[model samples]
Target: MAKSKLSEKEQVTEYIQKLDPSLAETITFLRQAILAIDGEISEHIKWNSPSFYYSGDMKPFNPKEYKRDILVMNLHRGTTILLVFPTGAKITDTSGLLEGNYPDGRKIAKIKDLDEAKSRQKDLENAIRNWMGQIEK
Candidate 1:
């Protein structure tokens, strides 16, 4: 059963906090990244996970329903995809991407270095834009 009084995004954030303190920074960065991509993007919790959705869309693409929207960008996005940082997970193959160990094996194309992160920002923005374009058609 879902916990009462907590929104989906809050639940996801609380889950991440339980996973590791280090992840707090990462989660914050991710939230900011999502906001940067689309100023109008809306955030919410879905299936106990934090989800960023396009504003005005009634559909809440939870982790389970992400496949329906190819542009949602998450772990389900094939090999090269965004890695969702679930509590207590670890990322093993973080070679050449970042300088630290990600507790979760989740692999997100999002990186940390200022320059690389900036590039990733562009990639993410473009992906969202493409998805929005399709939705508008």
Candidate 2:
């Protein structure tokens, strides 16, 4: 079957749909989580992939820019950091999740399943909060 050429938003929605059906709920949950953290959050297409960014901010958060394999969330603040998946997952510091590989020899955590994705969500949120706090400090 030929894959339809999707706009950036359609592509992202389609990617989420292709995940385990159960993950559909997780994707919505994550979107809400991101929005709740910052009301200024907005969506856009970057590098032919879906990305989230803050209003007035020059950078967008994209978790799929490494070798273009694992999905990643890039948060830019005072210190720009990339939150990669399980094998490339940098937040957990543990294994058992999805493995991530970077084109540049950088390893990230792979988000194996919905559960792992949720855990990563928490970590990402915490990191965002910490980053904001640092700016205030």
Candidate 3:
């Protein structure tokens, strides 16, 4: 039998399953929090990590714009889970969830552990929703 390719979400699940239990819990919680914001947002493996993107119909634009990308989980630093928000410069964040400035229009939100993750859950979701609200439908 041919080897089957895992679905995007299944791949994400597998990725989370391989993490340290604490990190896994945090990632899973944040993933749920993000997905709960909008039904159009979907997940996949991108940039060597589990990434989320908008799957809804939108006005066509240049692929270089990366308008469909929502966020990608960057776990290179171990305990610190970094959510990379592409085009995050567009969001008017007041919740203090976003940090750092990159000329490429990328911003990052960092979560350390489950306690911090739970506390910042609302802020994180708000920031993501802020990103989603600007999407061209």
lDDT of each: 0.47, 0.47, 0.90
Candidates in order, TM-scores: namely: 0.49, 0.45, 0.95
Give one digit per residue, the lDDT tens place, for model 3 in 1-137: 99899999999999999988889999899889888888988999899898999999999999889999999989998689899998999988998788989999999999999899999988888888888889898
Cα displacement (Å) at residue 65, model 3:
1.4
Q: Which portions of model 1 show Cα errors greater than 4 Å?
A: 1-4, 57-81, 84-119
Q: Give candidate 2's error at residue 136 in angstroms.
A: 11
Best lDDT goes to which candidate?
Answer: 3
Error of 1 at 35 (Å): 1.9
Error of 2 at 52 (Å): 1.5
Q: In angstroms, give how far residue 128 of model 3 lies from its true place.
A: 1.3
The Cα error of candidate 2 at residue 75, in Å, is 18
* Superior by TM-score: candidate 1 or candidate 3: 3
| Per-residue lDDT of candidate 1, residues 33-133 (tens digit) | 77776665767655444566656554444555342222222423222334342311222322333222464323245443334544566555554555555
For model 2, what is the C-alpha lDDT against the true structure? 0.47
lDDT of 2 by residue, 24-56 (tens): 565556656665776655554554434555443
| Deviating ranges (above 4 Å) for candidate 2 | 1-20, 57-109, 132-137
Model 2: per-residue Cα lDDT at residue 12: 68
